[model samples]
Target: MDRVEKQAALFNLPETIVPHSVLALGYPAEENKEPRESRYEENRVHFEKW
Candidate 1:
């Protein structure tokens, strides 16, 4: 097994505990902007119409 796999086994962790690239596929590449700000703006606009 590889080094990471060996360490995980030694620590009694499941094989699925490693980070998955798919989890980050949807994040923007730009680091200077906050994604949550846009989401909060959208929610605010939607609630204001009700």
Candidate 2:
């Protein structure tokens, strides 16, 4: 929080511009994982009207 606050203050940014938390991630250990199940369905939409 301190680091992010300093940066934001230096730029004179508004509080809305500051994030509640910042995440800096490294590379994942494994690349092989099952694909996630999608939440959406394809055939729900109508062509021209609902």
The candidate that wins on TM-score is 2
In model 2, where is the ten-residue run with the lowest total lDDT?
A: 41-50
Whole-model lDDT values for every prediction:
0.47, 0.62
What ranges in model 2 sit over 4 Å off? 19-50
Tell me the TM-score of model 2.
Answer: 0.35
Residue-level lDDT tens digits of model 2 in 1-50: 88888866765666777735534756669995786676767785333322
Per-candidate TM-scores read 0.30, 0.35
| Residues 16-50 of candidate 1: C-alpha lDDT, one tens digit per residue | 67522212236556786544544345543322122
Instruction: Report how far residue 23 has shifted in candidate 2, in Å.
Output: 15
Cα distance off (Å), candidate 2, residue 43: 37
Supply every candidate's count of residue pairs whose N, Cα or C atoms clash at under 3 angstroms: 0, 0
Return the clash pairs for model 2, or none: none
Instruction: Indicate the residue-level lDDT of 5 in model 1.
Output: 70
- Model 1 lDDT-worst window of ten: 41-50
